[model samples]
Target: MDSLTADDFFALDLPRHAQLIDGTLIVPEPQGNFHSVSPYVLAQGLRRTAPGRLRVRRQMCVVIGARDVPEPDLVVVNASADGGPCLMSYAARDVLLAVEVVSPDSEERAQDTKPRKYAAAGIRHYWLVTMDENNRPAVHTYELDPHTGSYAPTGIHHDRLKLAVPFTIDIDLTEIDRL
Candidate 1:
């Protein structure tokens, strides 16, 4: 295995999805605009409604453990800790939620890679947003069951989804279609 750590991965200027798993570097394909925007909308919504309960960030590197650091599309962390640096370096317990906007070229990465990684890292909540051909967003929310190391589907939102913390708000899916 490669001797790369999360610190080593962070030091690089590479563009694709570069993560460190078990001290090995993994570079997945790059993301597209459609993949990027959906998460942006969600992040903005979280910031506006639940400023105290949730922290919305984009492309923030989270260190799930010593050997793994993956930068998710949007990370919903504890609101009190918003200005902190490198999420990947934080303990898995600090991550309140993790969201991934699916890239057309990296469907498998979203469907398989992220779920396994996040579940292993002990993230409590995870979301996967899929964009239709017209670029509309469909949201799937998962809550991790630590006992099984599996995520149970909590809800699916097509047009709008209700967010639970910081404040109550609805994220309109129609905006995703515009992206």
Candidate 2:
């Protein structure tokens, strides 16, 4: 198919899981239980104490430009704008954080390509969560550099993910359940 405009993509009545990346529509591979629930766990954790302005959403479609609308595993955006939206999509500029949980189905996209798009779109923070052999979520975080238009590695989080951006929180990875 030819490259599609945002309107053309949305008007296709594509499934919710469909995403437009660089003008191509791709459907993410099927998710497992862990992939599905991790978002809920993260959302639950973030919303527990998030400030009113920030809302945590899973599989939130983001408009990265006219031809891309990739949905990150989780997104943190300003709730106060657009009457406190908790809906279909948000502009990339409104995104404060974007998280992608790595699964075998789409490892490279999560660890590589998606982060590039997120940073290029000027999203402030991006995280890639991958599971180890023993079933631990190892988080690699990134921060966008305005000067270079790229992302700089902040840290790789293991047992705990302590953050001061997109709100402050110290998450105990072991405490989060995934089945």
Candidate 3:
């Protein structure tokens, strides 16, 4: 078996869905319909409420380091002074909020894998949206406590939440569940 270090993984330019953690390659499962819809609804809601102040993107790759680039489901970036997408590679500092909508098959991916990685990457805000068996969604927001290297709950919105940046808008969880 071949042992791949983070450096080696970073050097490969293959264009498939993959992430490097420590020194291992993680192949992400394909996102399904529900997974796609949640981000869409959230992004649209955010954009409508906070136009020009926040940039919301779906599945945008955030380059935390040469060996660590994870495509978060929804990333809310600070409004660029130039009023355009911050085309430069995204870092922990640029991210105002990161969101992951859990797919039924990938609960662990959201609940565990991403939280740890985002914390390590120094992302200040993170959210994991989990869906019930019936596909009803529940949203959990985590704010990274830099000193502790852990995420602390700022709030849990079962129905709606007004995010911290880009704009102050309420997101309806029922609309997310319908998506």
Candidate 4:
């Protein structure tokens, strides 16, 4: 069989949550309730606070390479990349930030694989959300280090997340409990 390509990945009738990574199709297990709801909550917070020049979306994939298209929990892109209703994904250059809400099942990909790919794609920012000891949201932010083409830790937030880059973003992590 031929290896899956990004063009083929989009053309197939696959599950909504499926992803194409390194020419392989990966269908992750159904997420836990908290895992399932994290993106919605985070996206809601971002949408409400993001500058008009940016747009927030949930379960959107960024086309990083010919064989790499990983769908992140949430993606923030420039308003021009919104592409209206027909567009299914955004080009990597258009993505401003790629966010992954880490679940037990997805930790490896979220923490390692996806970040590497996003950084290589020149994405400006990446956010990884995980649960803290109290089972509340903790966001780890990273910015691309242009010299190395890798992400560097910017901050780790528990009670609240405040960032000036990618436009001002302030979120109360406890909001995850509402789910």
- Residue 127 error for model 4, in Å? 0.6
How would you encode candidate 2's per-residue C-alpha lDDT over 1-179 as one tens digit per residue?
89987778878878768888889998887898767766666677778767888888888789998988998999888885434444578899889999999888678888888888888899999888888565777888889999898899989887677888757867777665533
Better of 2 and 4 by TM-score: 4
Give one digit per residue, the lDDT tens place, for model 1 in 1-179: 46877667778786655767667776766667777677778877777775566667777777877677877788877766655673334446677788888776557767787778899888888888897555678888888887899888888788787867324768877876665
How well does each candidate superpose onto the true structure, as a TM-score?
Answer: 0.82, 0.91, 0.77, 0.96
Clashes of 1: 5
Residues 17-61, candidate 3: write the lDDT tens digits.
576544456677677777767777778777787667667777766
Predictions in order: lDDT:
0.74, 0.81, 0.70, 0.89
Q: Judged by lDDT against the true structure, how good is candidate 1?
A: 0.74
Q: Report the Cα lDDT for candidate 3.
A: 0.70
The order of the candidates by lDDT, greatest first, is 4, 2, 1, 3
TM-score of 1: 0.82
Kindly list the per-residue Cα lDDT of model 4 for residues 72-103, writing each as its tens digit.
99999999888898888999999999999888
The model with the greater TM-score, 1 or 4, is: 4
Give the backbone clash total of model 2: 0
Mind sharing the TM-score for model 4? 0.96
The TM-score measured for candidate 3 stands at: 0.77
Q: Superpose all Cα atoms of candidate 3 onto the true structure and report the RMSD in Å to 1 decimal.
A: 3.4
Q: Over 4 Å off in model 1, which ranges?
A: 83-90, 163-167
